[model samples]
Target chain A: MLKIDCKDKHFSEIGKTIRESKDKEIVIDNCLGHRYIASGVGGKDIVINGTPGNALGSYLDGCKIVVNGSAQDAVGDTMNDGIIIIHGNSGDATGYAMRGGKIFIKGDAGYRAGIHMKAYKDKFPVLVIGGKAGSFLGEYQAGGIILVLGVNTDSKTNVGYFTGNGMHGGKIILRSDELPDLPPQIISRKANAEDLQEIEKYVQEYCSYFGGEPKDIMEKSFYVLTADSANPYKQLYTSL
Target chain B: MAINYIYPVYEVVRNASRCVNCKICEKQCANGVHKFDAKNGIMIADESKCVNCHRCVATCPTRALKIVKSDNTYRENANWSAESMKEIYKQAESGGVLLSSMGNPQPLPVYWDKIVINAAQVTNPSVDPLREPMETTVFLGSKPDEIVRDKDGKIVDNMTSQLKLSTPIMFSAMSYGSISYNAHASLAKAAEKLGIFYNTGEGGLHEDFYRYGKNTIVQVASGRFGVYKDYLEAGACIEIKVGQGAKPGIGGHLPGTKIVGDISKTRMIPVGSDAISPAPHHDIYSIEDLRQLVYSLKEATGYKKPIAVKVGAVHNVSAVASGIARSGADIIVIDGFRGGTGATPTRIRDNVGIPIELALASVDKRLRDEGIRGNVSLVVGGSIRNSADVIKAIALGADACYIATAALMAMGCHLCRSCHLGKCNWGIATQVPELVQRLDPEEGCDRLVNLVNAWTHEIKEMMGGMGINSIEALKGNRLMLRGVGLNEKELEILGIKHAGE
Candidate 1:
């Protein structure tokens, strides 16, 4: 394991050091506001301390990024394959357009979490927010699994307003009985045994990283939000 | 019968004298407009189904068919024209947004027509392009503001990654879902042969065209479709599509129906999922945000390829372009309102953005004033009609001009404006296997090569007439341009004098 101090280092310098280093397991300390950390990088275990900036692990391909502190906007953006575990809260667009990856957040996430997240073939992205998610959560989500546990929230609804607007695919499972005001296209129902079974591994994985019992978290009634058809806006156009 | 039946816009004219009853027109039309009446021993026409793509006219062995605008009347009113009435009827019946293909069809002012090029007369003799060597090759990327020297005082290579084009022309972005596979193949082959680039748009690169990576500009839009490390590394340059001119400030939704097989595979989506490229990149909101994306892409690609930011020529396009120039982008592509699209809302397409001509001139002047012009190369597109337009664009401060509509025309598109329906008989914009096979890639490539070569020759001729030997010398040389029928404000904005000034 290589321990690197990023006290006065630029983002590029830190990135260059990581790319050039032969060490498989590396740790970055004082990683404040350094964007694009481990972007498109693979085959490494990167652990960052301090508040990392936006786009952490963007286009991350087959790497594991563990952020000890909070992560800013656009965490795991367009990430093809990887695992990004954030111990603290996350900013906006936690998993923007990510095709394949697993992003587990211990605390709440900001707006547009898991927006436009898609799935292809065997690759499916899973974003689990232990705490509540901000407004416009899972907007335009094509495919993938987004689970908002609302770990410490007092309110019944974990997600904010306009949830699943323009969503065409995927499932948004919230551990709450009362549902948020979802968009017209989205259909909401209680998570069946099969649905819960499918996300059991992810829930267990999230609990492993964030420190919680999967059974305790799964005790509540989870509401699943999904769109029926893949093409929600199919009838919105008239050929001129 | 429905009371809101609008008359067909075009009428099929089949010449009885020239008719050979070959049934080629019926076989050629994908819209099913023509049919053979075996009992009548003749061909029947469905004018209502006609898009006037002229595919049948071109395919007819004996030149027996033609399409003409209908002479049908609905009382002449300039305010509420026949087109307006038909559009009203369409919306009233469907209760959906009227979607159209291709560019804006409105008879708005085309600045290129008003701008005229200058030529050397008595004072300076013009160089004959045939006798003298003329340079049309252009390199697009950021240039170092000043020369850097090593410790030994040796001049170091300060140049960034640059795309070398044999001519100042490139095939603009047109995705696989929007166009046909054969059309993409043709563009890729032609771009390879021409030493230019053809953009993959936002559909992502098809696996088959990976070999043409050197001549391709892979795009990343709001949706970030098909964008992985390999896709980014496959292209010569990566273009970030901020906005499109056809429907400025709006997102692109390649309908679920068009998402089939390869298109779905290329986009990395399901077989029938709507590929929604939202209006704004959810991650990008400000110039600072854009810089993050640019740097993120750079990091992903290891800073090897040049990154381009493309935006529609909206009212504040110059300001937007200036921001892009400072956003670590190596190239700024300004697409005008006349840019083509597979589908867009009719109202937004016609009424949203500004012209490329004015936008380019203003952006060039602004960047130069800020002394950051060398930070990024300017590539303008929207309606570069011919070689003349290309030359005019270079003189008006463009490193290169992107051509899509013209390239589509070279690939046999008749401008039928029915691409949204996916029934393009010319095979340029359809996905149906049979319809797509109509456009032979070899033939299409040959035609595109011929068109580009012809345009390059014309550009050289114009450059020779102007006593300019190299394309780089004409970059931002607005003194070589003069506005003929433009107002004072227009001339001022274009940074060109009126004719005979």
Candidate 2:
């Protein structure tokens, strides 16, 4: 494993140093507020000691990244085919426009997490927020799975307002007794046995990343929010 | 539902002597404008269904067809026009926002027509492009501030990202889903033949066109559709579509009907689902955020490709261009208000954004003043009609010109402004199997190549006439240009002297 101390290093330098590494497994120390460190990087294992900046694993493909501390906004942005596990909480847009891959945040997430995330064929991105999430969660989500655990939060609400706004496809699993005031475009339901079984792999994997009992976490009734895909398209111009 | 609506603006007039009952117009009209009335035993024209696309006229074997403006008129008032009244009627009936296709049809100021070029007089002699070498080749990207010489006296070049073009023109972005697959084929083939690039627009690049990767510039928009590792790697350059001039500050919505089959697969969205590109990239709320995305694309491609940020030419266009220049982008494309779109709100298309001519001049001046002109290349796109428009754009401080409407016209688009309907009979902007197949790629490519070839030749001749030898010499050389029928303010904005000065 190639280890480098990224103290006082610019985002570009960190990116370059990480890029120059020949080792498949690399460790970054003192990774304070450095943005776009492993952006579009894949085929390697990256372990971050401290907070990495926004857009940390943007466009990431087929790699595994572990963050010892919290991460900034836009973590795992538009990332595809990768695994990013953040031990601490994440900021806004945790999985912004992510098409594929799985991002496991150990704690609460800020606003707009999992916004515009999509899935195609076998590439279904899974973003599991361990704690309560902020407003506009899963907004305009075309596809993919976003699961918010609400693990340990004092807030009465599991998630914030405008959840799943303008969402067209995919499934959002929220582990909460009741959902917040939702938009007209979205529908929420209690997770059935089939739904629980469907998210079993992700729950198990998320638990592996940040220790938790799968049975206890999975026991609670999960709220599944989805876009009303039944909304038919109307021509704004002329009908004929 | 209220049923009474205004008749179409035009009437399809058929010459009886030339009408052979071929029924080609009846068969060819995608809008169902013409149909053989079996009960009447005659082909009847439905004016309301006609978009005035001229598909019938063009395809008429004996030149039997002509579309004339209907002699229908309400109480004519300049303030409330017939179209406005019709629009009100439309809204009252459907309660739907008025959506339009292509550029603004309103009588807005077209700065291109008001600008003119100066010819070589007594002091300077015009060179013959045929006899002498008049270079039209342009290299788009960052240029070195100053040349460095090595100990051996060889000039060391620092220019890393550059798109070498035989002409100062390129086909602007028109996505596969927005246009037909055959239309894309024509553009790719033409770009390859012309040694210029064609943009993939916000639409994802089709799989078959991956072979034309060398001539393609893949686009990443807010929707992030079909943007993957292979797609990013396929393009010679990548463009982040921040905004389009036609619909400024608003996202794009490709209706579900257009997303069929391969288009659905190419865009990576579900078949027949609306492909909505949000107004803002949720992550990018600032210039710094744009820089991050730019760097991400660069890192993805190992920094081998240049990143271009395409933004609408808004009121703060110069400042926006400056920000993009500082945003780690190698190229900046400012699409002016006259630029075409697959679909945009009619109000937004007509009212929003400034003209390209004004935006280009302002951006060039601002960049030059900021001493960052060499940091990024400027590409101007918005109704670049002919060689003169391209030359004028170059003089106004553009490295290259991107032509979408002009290119489409060359590929047999009559500009009916009905692209939103997705029933293009010319096979240019539809996804239906029959319509998409109507545009033969070979013929499309030939026409496109022919158009650009003529434009380049004209550019060379015009450059020669100005006593200019190279595109590099002519670019941002405002002295060679002048404004005609323009006020002092217009002249000042255009950075040119009046004609006969």
Candidate 3:
């Protein structure tokens, strides 16, 4: 257990120092509004205590970032392979455009959560939100699996309006029985046994990380799946 | 013989008496509507092929041509015109795709021609370019908020990165795979000669063109293709391509067929696989994330080269520009929806994003209001058609203009817009061995040089006409422009008054 006190040092200095150090289990305490913490780190376990600024663990190849407090926007943005555990609320665009990683958030998220998340071959990105998400969730999502578990009962909807807008590819699993008010372009259907099977591992992982029973999370009544049509979008202005 | 009862709905009348044998109209016509019949000792006209671009009418030396709608009606149904019926019949007969270029050339009310340029009459003395030294040279980089001086009260060396241009024009990014090697060489050579810059669009720089590094703006896109330590350090500046004008929300895709030996090696992609750049730079999500990449590139290159982020002009572009202004980017390159692309899904290309004029105006206004205009310089592009458009763009508030499709046209692009087919007969767009050979780099370079030189002269003349000498003085001086036949909304968006009124 290596604990580094980041009381007043800037994000750049602290990040540079941590990156150079060979410590595997590191805890950064009192990290207030510092950006790019644990960015581009490979093969390390970084535990951040305080509220970190934007771009937390960007381009993270292989690392585990556990943010004990809330995080600003763009958490785990474009991270290749990593496990991001956010114990508190997250700002807009959380896990945005993530390629290959697992971001498990235990709190609510701002707008555009998991927008543009994509997958390549065997490497698939998975984002699990334990709370409600803002608008434009999974927008233009080419690939990846996004699961939003509506744990908070205060909000009327699990995801806001225009959810899955311009979503060409990818599977979005919502634990709520009520279907999210999506755009006209996206087609939604009840998740079958095969769909639940595909996301079973992710749900299991989320449960293990957040200390919840996987069976309780999977016991939800229905799952909504949204995807764009095969020959989606016409050439409106120009001749195809 | 089956008699085709196709009536000419529009007659292209050419006055033989006023016609001159100069053939400027014939040369400029991309639709091949006009032809010079040497055996007949006259120019012939083919009205059937004409889409009525008016290039011939506009460029006719003797003003010998006019296009008129004929009363040859097929039916009284105004909903379906004779032209529309002909178009459907043509599509049915050909079983091929429809192609068009330059923009939605439909009568969408071009706001540019409506706006007018103002002149200095008596209040402000218009400096003459012929007499005084006019400064068109623009430095595109982050301007310091406040100059930090040393103890001696002399200027300190704490300035941010910037790109210096001899003129306010830059050759915009057209990738090696998108265009031929000869075309790229031509642009590189011309940029070197003219003291401007040419961009290496996400496809990494070719080793042969490294000698022209001084005038190169290397791009780093989503896929990080061709991005290495050496590639980053090669160019004068680095541009992070988030989006392009042609396809605002979509990524670029160079078909597998075009990715050859050098392109494949440069892009770091396997041969015969589509070089697809993901829509978003996977590493970037927020403004702060964008800053990391910006700083990363800066740190990678030892902060020697200025970093630019290119994005399409979308709604809320002003807010986006403000974000980019604070994103540690030295320069912000905003591409309008009217910009050209090598290959984009036809739908995405045409229907995405706002026009350059509106975007530029709003961005400039917003930055100025925020007092962060000094943080980054504006580089506007997409469809800068002529010297007049360049002048208008600068006045609308771009520090510099990027000309790609126009530059290619100057180097002899027929605007066939068949670049996706990769069989460009003009050698500007295609990578085919035989087709590529058609364009000589030296000649193409010369033509580009000639085009820029001509535009420079025209710019000077327009400036002179406005009684303004330097381009620096012309930048953001919207008083020089007035909108004609424009509504209040259009005029307000353009930041100009009605032309005559």
Candidate 4:
């Protein structure tokens, strides 16, 4: 256990030192508004005891970053392949435009969660939010799987307004019976047998990461599955 | 029933006595209105083909030609006029939308024409171009904040890389798909010949044209179409197109109709599918994110090529430019609202961004005030009409100017503004087989070479008239320019003065 107290050091500097260090198990204490912490790391186990700033684990290749506190906007942005476990709530644009990787948030995510998240062949990205999300949850999402589980017992609606706008491809699973007020471009339905089969691995991974029973969450009831319309962007711009 | 006869609606008359047979008017008339018939003793006029561009009237040596509306009559129906009915019938038959090009040429106020330039007489000493070497060559790159040297008394490290050019003029990006192959060839050849650079608009570079890589500025837009390692490494510079002047808030859509064999292969998309470039880059959400992309591309290319960020000249452009300058961009290209495009929504095209003049002035002033002007170079474009406009642009603090419409005009565009129809009679804008064949690359390149050469001489003459020798000396030299009929706000925004006041 290597513990480093980042009292007054800039987040970038501390992150650089941590990344350069050969230590596998590292703990960063008193982390206050430090940006790009544990960014672009290859293989390391980083635990943040305090609040980290924006762009946490950006372009992370193969690292496991666990944040004890909430993070700022653009957490795990464009990360290729990594695992980010946020214990608390996150700011807006969480997992934004992520290409590949898995991000597991124990708490809620802000607006535009997984916006434009994409995946190529053999590289599928997964983002699971334990609590509710704000508006425009998956705007312009081209590929990948995004699941929002309203584990916080206070609310039932896991996602907010205009969800899945301009979504051309991909699947979104919401652990809520109430259908979200979505745009006209997206088609929403109860999780069918086929949809459940597809998300089985992702749900199992989410359960494994958060130490929750996958059967308990799955047996409770319906999941809202959203996909883009056949002609999602047909009339979005102009008549001509 | 006998058909009602109507005389000609308009007559294009030519006075043979005043005609000098120089053919300047004939050459200038791109609409094929006037042509010399070898079989006949006099020049022949075609009335139906005339769009009344007045090029003949402007270029006639003896003012020999005149245009008049003929006193012809049709069944006077205000809503269902003969022309309107014909247009409706054509649309009903073809089932196609109407498309136009260039600037809004329908009697709209051209701010460029309204604005005028000033000269130095007795009050300020304009340097003599004949005696002194006027510095027209501009280095577009980041400048050093503080020089660092080693103990050996030699300069060790500089701040930013510079793009050196012989003249303060560049060919703006016109993608391969948007224009014909011959047009791209002509532009590429001309840029190589003139020692300037031409931009390969977001379309990927063809394999054959890679030899002109030194003279090309490859563009990367949201779609990331044709963006490969080689494409990034193939150019002298790379431009990240955020938004265009013609349609600021909209993305690019190459209709399925234009997606031919080579274009489909180059764009890496299926044929008959619309090539959609999203409005915003999926990776960039803020200025810091934009910085990341800039650096990422730099890293991908090993920092050898200069990276340019091209944005529309919108309101608050100064602040936007300030952000871009600090965002590690090497060059900031501010495209004015009047820039040309192959296709754009008419509503957004006309109403989206600010004029180039005001945007350039504001951006230049903002960067200079921050003392970070050396951090990035500024290139302004929208509608640079002539050499005079180029001189004025540089004096207003632009490192260079970009000319697309002017270049098209040199290649025989009639300014009909019907490029979207893809049936350009002049062969300058269309990609149709027949229309494309009209423009020969060799001849087109020669004409472009001739146009720029003429403009270079005229630029030198203009500099000489101001007694300034080089373009560098003329940069931000607003005192050499004065505004005519411009208000205080216009003068302040343009950073110039009223003529002779």
Candidate number achieving the greatest DockQ relative to the actual structure = 1
- Give lDDT: candidate 4, residue A210: 73
At residue B23, candidate 1 shows an lDDT of 90
lDDT of 3 by residue, A23-78 (tens): 78999999898877776566889899989987787656678999999998878765
Comparing candidate 2 with candidate 3, which one achieves the higher lDDT? 2
lDDT for B300 in candidate 3 is 45
Q: Alpha carbon lDDT of residue A69, candidate 4?
A: 89
| Residue runs of model 3 more than 4 Å from their true location after superposition | A1-7, A12-240, B1-102, B121-125, B150-154, B282-288
Clash-forming residue pairs, model 1: none
Question: Model 3 in CAPRI terms: which quality?
Answer: incorrect
Q: Please provide, for model 3 over B1-501, each residue's C-alpha lDDT reduced to its tens digit, 9 standing for 90 to 100.
A: 123345655577889999977887676654466889999889887876565545577668789998887777777577786656765665565454444334433344455666677776787676677766667788999988887888999988788777888888899988888888999999999999999999999888999998999999999887566665567778999999998888887776565567678887766555655555767875577897788788656544556889999999999889999999999898999998888887675545657788889999999999999999999999999888888888998998899999998898887776656566565666777777766876899999999888888888778878887877778888898888888777899778877777765
User: What shift in Å separates residue B290 of candidate 2 from its native position after superposition?
Assistant: 1.1
Residue A46 of candidate 4: its Cα lDDT?
A: 88
TM-score of chain B of each: 0.99, 0.97, 0.82, 0.82
DockQ of each: 0.87, 0.53, 0.09, 0.08
Best-fitting candidate, scored by TM-score: 1
Considering summed lDDT, which 10 consecutive residues are worst modelled in model 4 chain B? Answer: B1-10
What lDDT tens digits, residue by residue, belong to model 4 across residues B1-501?
123222435688888899877777666655577788777667788876665555577668799988888666566586676654544544555454434456533233445665655555887676665576767778887777888889998997765556778888899988878888888889999999988999989878888788999999999887656665567778899899999888787777676577677776565444555566778876577898788667656654556778999999899899989999999899999999889988776656667788888898889988889988888899989999889889888888999998898898888775756566565656666667766776898999999999998888789878877767778888888886777777899888877778776
Q: What tier of docking accuracy does candidate 1 attain?
A: high
| Candidate 1: C-alpha lDDT | 0.92
List candidate 2 segments past 4 Å from native: A230-240, B1-3, B146-157
The residue-by-residue lDDT of candidate 4 on A105-212, one tens digit each, is 888998988886766555567888988888888886766889988885566667888888867566788888677777776777788898777666766877786778
Q: Whole-model lDDT, candidate 2?
A: 0.88
Candidate 2 residues B16-109, lDDT tens each?
A: 7788888999888888988877896677798888889999999999999999999899887989988888888888787788888998788988
